[model samples]
Target: MNFLNLEIYLDYIKDNGYRCTPQRSSILSYFIGQKNRFVTAKSVTDHLQNKMGNVSSDTVYRNLHLFKDIGIIDLTFQDGESLFHLKNEINTHEYKFICTECGNTTDLNLCPMEKMDTALNDYLIYDHKFEVYGVCPSCL
Candidate 1:
């Protein structure tokens, strides 16, 4: 992802009546640095601890959820862990099949909503998560 995408997120928070704090900026920067990959809050906290010297897990998790709420990131569960990844602009509706052993993710180009019951389309839908978990080829 281009570094310019950082500005897009900054603009989003600003539009939502929120100021970009040092921690928030750092957290977003860390995610941007990761490009397109699933990462854990603990991984982020460890990175911040190595770079900034002091950061709490709670702070990391809070900012992660905040980013998710603002549509900047998406979450998935794989093998008992919640992994996060940046939502790509081109494939916002794509879901993934995650490897339980290796944490590898393969994008499914179609939207899972198409599989939903027709009668349930009357209400609003804020978000959804659909992932298939199993061993990857290498792990087999």
Candidate 2:
């Protein structure tokens, strides 16, 4: 396990007046271990439960929300379900293609928002999220 990645999350919680508990540690470790992939709360909960036993889905969701609040992760909706991915540390902007058939994600380099700049003028935009869904090649 990379202690540095875990430390960053622990330090963030500490700086924000939150205690670092065993559960929170495990959750952060899981995300760090599986970086660059979107995962559902049930998947996380099940994995932890198999090893630790008694890990609840609610606990996972609550911790996920905290992580999102701290800007360490971002959420996307697909097929009526919520999926999570770590916030990009380098480039914060990129549109994504989400595969509905297999839940795969592909980042697109082009920014469609660029074309909307002229049409969206006069509107103050603090942030934006863009994700399109379809069957991936392998899934198709």
TM-score for every candidate vs. truth? Answer: 0.78, 0.76
Which residues of candidate 1, in runs, are more than 4 Å off? 1-4, 90-92, 119-125, 135-140
CA shift at 123, candidate 2, in angstroms? Answer: 1.8
Q: What is residue 27's positional error in candidate 1, in angstroms?
A: 1.6
Model 2 poorest 10 in a row by lDDT: 86-95
Local accuracy of candidate 1 as per-residue lDDT tens digits, 1-140: 33327778887888878889888888878877775668988888998888788899998898888878777778876658788876665225547777777666677777668777465678877767777777779889
Residue pairs in clash, model 1: none
* Candidate 1 lDDT (Cα, 0 to 1): 0.76
